[model samples]
Target: MSIYRKDIYVFDGDRPVKALIRSYTEADFEGLIRIQQESFPPPFSPELWWNEEQLGNHVRLFPEGALCVEIEGELAASMTGMLVNYNPGDPDHSWVEMTDAGYICNHLADGNTLYVVDIGARPAYRKLGLGKWLMLSMYEVVVRLNLQRLLGGGRLPGYDRVADEMSAQDYVQAVIEGKLKDPVLTFLLRCGRTPVRLMADYLDDEESHNYAMLMEWRNPFLPQES
Candidate 1:
């Protein structure tokens, strides 16, 4: 129930560090918590962080979709997701409902869409392409599961800097057009994910103005239906 990728590496300044991306194990519980806390600071409620039960449920529901990364024998990053089915025209769930308030509620195995519930990297590992690596790794899961696409909500961390100057949609459009840089959504866009719409009250982060960008990344290899 683990995927081992040997070729992935991220650089800390000029030092090249190899990272092992694999499925979660019972032993990784503490490491996951530490990294989660480091990646997401305060303002995210305590209930939003991963606990043993929630992590265990994710492993039980979809082991292949639950993955972690290790660098120099230390757990540095992780990504969790679940299978779901929804109409492309209207997605009914927000980040809270889809992830069971960040714990992942119901995972539909027969569903064609792979929902990225959560993902984070250690502070020291930021800007090293680790997040992008993990995201691309999720795409591998989608292909292996024969899913239609990958979907998730991206936090607008840069919103607070210019909220009074523009609307959320305007901010998103600015990011897409390269007029502004959102630490989260811009990177997602660079990774080939498209912003579908703005989601209100998606999470508790005040930095994003309690908003998020609903995004999607289709599997290019999958056949399209007319």
Candidate 2:
């Protein structure tokens, strides 16, 4: 726990980073789509991002808080709030149809869990701590709602386990060699999120090369600021 407490503050790095965390707005939807399109594959359509953006907005309606961050006047990042008791009728809740939806649904069929559904940082400004800042912002929001934990599916690329393909294995090796930034998973760990890879076989289908990992945060509070 103490090891992770230190992870919350800005490290001694140089990137001219300044983050402002706040709620999602109607005006911010398109910008959010732009950010998502830049960071991941099979990116969300404007309509999809718009719907997900609205879902993220639900964090504010609950005792739980949600936030988006603007860095240097650009919509740099967003942290969607999760519902602790996720009954659709309960405040604001969401269930998505993803490539792995069926697998994840059957895998963890019964439960009430809050998840950080959408998290992405702009490409150019990535590797800076801005992403972590956004994550900690979400962490604070979870605690404010007095929620015990958060849940979500994280980095599910086409090749999760089998790195037989040179390109795919190279990518994994790059991560081992410190050449790639596993920002999302790293942030999940720093927040003490435990992730389980679900639907590992989906990688066989190139189109559905989607790999999903479940990230759980048992204690959703940030380390006290000294």
Candidate 3:
């Protein structure tokens, strides 16, 4: 029930690269591992990383939600997500719980929210709009499944530089107001996602101070009530 195929294309420096945005396959294991390692280095610990077995389970559990981008048959970026019944009124959940510490055991087929587990673009392919395209691809999945919203932890890569001067909440607010340009949070905000709250100990990343911005993008295509 995948809404996206491998027909998408994005230009790589005016070269007109033919990119394939599609579901994850066993053959992509090595590529995914390499991308994760390269995209998120030291700050992202080995304990917080996803392995071949965990990623394979995601494909088996929710093939439609697992997406990968290939440029000229080389894996460029990948996004992993799952459907979950999220209660907006409830407190923000930690990354460990949402992604099951990268095991992805929280996926629920009949859930109303699409929880984005992880999304990363290889260092070489950065700024090619691959991340945005992958997100839009997931948005398509949301519309196709009639999900309520898309949820994930938005990393604050620019926080460490300013943490001594303000709180995480204040940093997020500044980013939203365009006063600050956080590498991750700012991009998510630009993509129409809203910061719900600042989550402490969300992950093991020292760059983010183990903090993450709980973000959500409500689906505009949800059916109206009668």
Candidate 4:
């Protein structure tokens, strides 16, 4: 069941098209796979694409965290996540380990953090504010559930070109300072996520040089700890 639903609009040239944001259902499996393929095209590892087992796990384990935006019954964007009792003291962890190899088998029912495993939009839907809406919807979940924060590994797709010119830490700092613009990191930052640290070897993507920035978006409704 979709616990949340919203009607949104996106533009195709000057015409506004209706879109729907809601939790994912088993019916959305094929559309989800298409979005994954479009978002991560050839030259990117096909092995990393969403598999039936992984999608089934998401639908079965944490349906609320599996969400998508649809335009005329066609999926335009999607995001998936799960809850975890995050450990800040030992913050370094691979994407595989954190997401249970994309199965989300380790999802914690009482976890205080919403861990974003993956998010992407079809190329045609980019910059339509669909991503932001999906992200904000997740934030709403954080507030509604009284979670501590939303966490994700922000990719640095723009880092590879400058990998020889600067370290990953310097590259991330530059992006945070607006000296550089990373497709993924910039989008995450604009969505109110702040860099927690530079996480190395987080993935096998050549574009990000296998590094991802750990990002955090704290719930303002939650009281601060001393």
Best by lDDT: 4
In lDDT terms, how accurate is model 4?
A: 0.90
TM-score on alpha carbons, each prediction: 0.94, 0.61, 0.94, 0.95
Q: What does candidate 3's lDDT look like per residue over 77-181, in tens digits?
A: 999998888887777778888877777777888999899999999989976789988998898888888899899999888899999999888888888889989
Q: Which ten residues in a row have the lowest lDDT in candidate 2?
A: 1-10
- The CA-based lDDT of model 2 is what? 0.50
Task: Please list the C-alpha lDDT of all candidates, in the order they appear.
Answer: 0.85, 0.50, 0.85, 0.90
What 10-residue stretch in candidate 1 is worst by lDDT? Answer: 1-10
Give the Å shift of residue 68 in candidate 3. 0.5
Which scores higher on TM-score, 2 or 4? 4
Best by TM-score: 4
Which of the predicted structures, 1 or 3, would earn the higher TM-score when compared with the native? 3
User: Number of backbone collisions per candidate, in order?
Assistant: 1, 1, 0, 0
lDDT for each residue of candidate 2 in 118-208, tens digit (9 for 90 to 100): 6777777666656667666666545644555566665534343444644543553454465654544445566566644343432223432
